[model samples]
Target: MRHLYIHVPFCARRCSYCDFAIAVRKRVPAARYVETIRREHALRREREPGWDTPLDTLYLGGGTPSLLPPGDLADLVTTFALNSDAEVTLEANPDDVTLDAAAAWSSCGVTRVSLGVQSFHAAVLEWMHRTHDVAAAERAVETLRAAGIGEVSLDLIFALPAGMEHDFRRDLERAIRLAPDHLAVYGLSVEPRTPLARWVARGRTVLGDDEQFAHEFLLAHEILTEAGFDHYEVSNYARRLPQGGSRRARHNWAYWNDAAYAGLGPSAHGFAEGIRRWNVREWVAYERAVARGNDPIEGKERLTPAQRALERVYLGLRTVAGIPAADLANPSSSRSFLAATDAGWLTTRAGRVYATPSGWLMLDALAAALTTSPEGG
Candidate 1:
């Protein structure tokens, strides 16, 4: 396996905009979850005997992975076979980060920490209901650095409510000043029936319009690129390593490259051998299923060839690596592809095709423009 992802689903409280499968309880079920994860790992290893699968990345993502004590995270790492220099990453809320916590993580082999800062602005943070204030978030970054965590990535949300009165440039500037090894700045989306969605539905909140969206998106591209960060993927940026390269999130890169990976724990998803699978979101049900020697997977599908091809085009366009020129320039989609080049939305260099910043803003259309029917017409 190229990567192993463990989903830690316990959170102190649900964020307003979150729709991830998580269990919010005052008393977290950390011990039970850790033991269950160990059992799941053993079961998985026994069923596959694939310990020989050399994993280069291990990502502990979640509702809140930093909620666990360092010991549990360490045990989880030992349970799997990992590369000597595997990039082990854990997602942490700002409030959970501390000098001691970071030291513990470093001691236990965690090489990266992704902090959920959301925003440095107080009102925006309030709207998101994040526990950590701007001061706390800033301190969290400093503390992680002081404890010697090699990489720290901050998460920021833009496109706030209409009257939120915050500047996107300010947020980007603050992020640059922090000099985090990585940054994930995403536009706020009100997913289905979450609290934010409900508020929007009731006309109690206003999501930014298209013009504001374009302004902020383009502004970030300019600012971040100027700051020497590589815009590696649509929403991700990586700092230039001292040795003259990017410290990109390898696990996430694996996903974009369509590499095989294992996903463990409730609500986790995995893609392997052309198959996509996911476990049940409910922890109790997932545990019972695993305990009874049943596969925790609630659903799975073998992607068709066409589906795979479509995913390749879509995902590739989302990154700086556009789909291969040869694959996309078939007779059928030639006109659309040529039109993009004519309009200065796409560019080709050396051998690979890449989307210009403007083209990236219209990724869905740009990717679709390269798709041809199975008959090659």
Candidate 2:
């Protein structure tokens, strides 16, 4: 595989809105986690032919990848056969960043760090159960710079509940002032069974409506683009270079382009040759499966032609590099193409149909309308 994603599921504390597969721990099991991953990789190498080949990108995403000790993190990255110029990314929390830790990460070949600075407001941070304060978040960015990391990406969450005290615009401005190389701006979703959902259900808090969500999304697009950041994907923006292109996240692009990637660790998903697979949801279950010399894959699906086509169109429309125009040659797509353009949802340029920020906010409905049929129905 050219790209690989290793999910590190250790977290110091679970964020209020988090429903991700994570094991909250007072003391992280760094060494044990690394050893488990090594075992899993070894097992995969035997079954998949090119699994051992050099990777173009390696993403260490997480509960908090930065929670691992620097030496342990280095060991995990070195375990992979990566291309010399491979883009290695680690997802970090602002409080976890230290100059020494960041320097060690760079020394071990981490070219990029994605900091989870959900919001710059202290109250919002506390409401979200984030471990760091605004000051720490700012310091983390400067520390990453001092460590000489090639790229720094900051994450922000907008469209919070009306009850929460936050100014989305101010947060955006603060993030821009920091001058991160990239930004991943996401809308706050009150996922089911999470603390946020419980609060909403009990009438303790209320999420914003679609209008608020749209407003915040558009506002981000305006501010970021005006600041010379390229809104390349639905929720991603990259700093545009003075001379030319933008500093896009290469690893994520692999997914947007439907390139096959291998995923390891609990709850990680992988897709190859039309088959999608995921590991066991719990860490203990995944570790046990690997220890027993069995594939940790809990289940897999081989998508049908129609399913694949719909997915292609859906994934394509989510990015700036949209699907080929010819892919939308169905009667349903052809009928709405003009209406969609007239509504300012998309634009056809250079033979590719690109979605505007507004269209991205309504990606699901738009993709469904434009999805092509396999049997020419």
Candidate 3:
């Protein structure tokens, strides 16, 4: 596999809306976590020859990969053989960024940093229980750039709970002023069993309606695109280079392109040779399994032809790179495509169907309509 993902599951505290697999700890077991990851890598390499190949991208994502010490980050990164031009990324909390930390990461070959700057509003940050404030978010970007990191990506959340007094447009403007290489703009979701869900269930708060979601989504598309960022993916935007190149997140592109990748660590999922596999979600169980020299895999699925075809349509529609018309050869899919195009939700150019900004707002429903229809697959 040319792409590798390592999930670091330790977090200082769980965010209000997060449903990710994370182990909350007052003090992270940095050394132990590093050792377990190393052992897991060695074991996998012994069994799978694919693990020996140099990686084109290495993404350290999680519960705050920046929480790890710089030395530990270096050690984990050094374990893999990476291509000279490989994209190495780390997901960091804004408060975790420091000049020293950023410099050390750059020295150790981390080319990009994705900062979790969910919002610039103080009230929203408090409600979300984020560890960083507005100032830290801006400082993080400056630190990354000052340390010579090649790319900086900022994440922003909109469509907050109703009556929260959030100014999403202000957040977008602030992000643009920072001039990040990429931006991942997302709508707040009340995941089941999360604190936000509990609040909704208990009538403590109300999530925004569909109208709010669409309005904010379209606003981001408008604001970011106008600022000269390319709307490359449904929820992602990249700064356009002077020569017309882009700073798109190459690692995530692998997923959109349906390429094989290797995933290591608890709750990490990997796809290869037509099979999709995932490891146990909890860190304790994962570490124990690895310690016992057993695969920590919780389950796997071998995708069928129909599933793959549906994925091709669904995933392709989420990107600016539209799918070929041939992929929708079925009569039902063709009809839906025509209807969507007429509704200003899609535009066909050069035999490929691309989703307009309005269409991306309804991406899930549109993709579902195409796939669920009779003969869709």
Per-model TM-score versus the true fold? 0.96, 0.97, 0.98
In model 1, which residue pairs have backbone atoms overlapping below 3 Å? none
* Residue ranges of candidate 1 with Cα displaced over 4 Å: 331-333, 372-377
State each model's C-alpha RMSD to the native.
1.8, 1.6, 1.3
Query: Can you tell me which runs of candidate 3 are displaced by over 4 Å?
Result: 330-333, 375-377
Mind sharing the TM-score for model 1? 0.96
Cα lDDT tens digits, model 2, 228-316, are 99999999999999889999999999999999999999999999999999999888888888888889999999999888888898889
- Model 3, residue 10: displacement in angstroms? 0.8
Assess each prediction's global lDDT (C-alpha) against the native: 0.85, 0.91, 0.91
C-alpha lDDT of candidate 3 relative to the true structure: 0.91
Comparison by lDDT, 1 against 2, better one = 2
lDDT for position 244 in model 3: 85
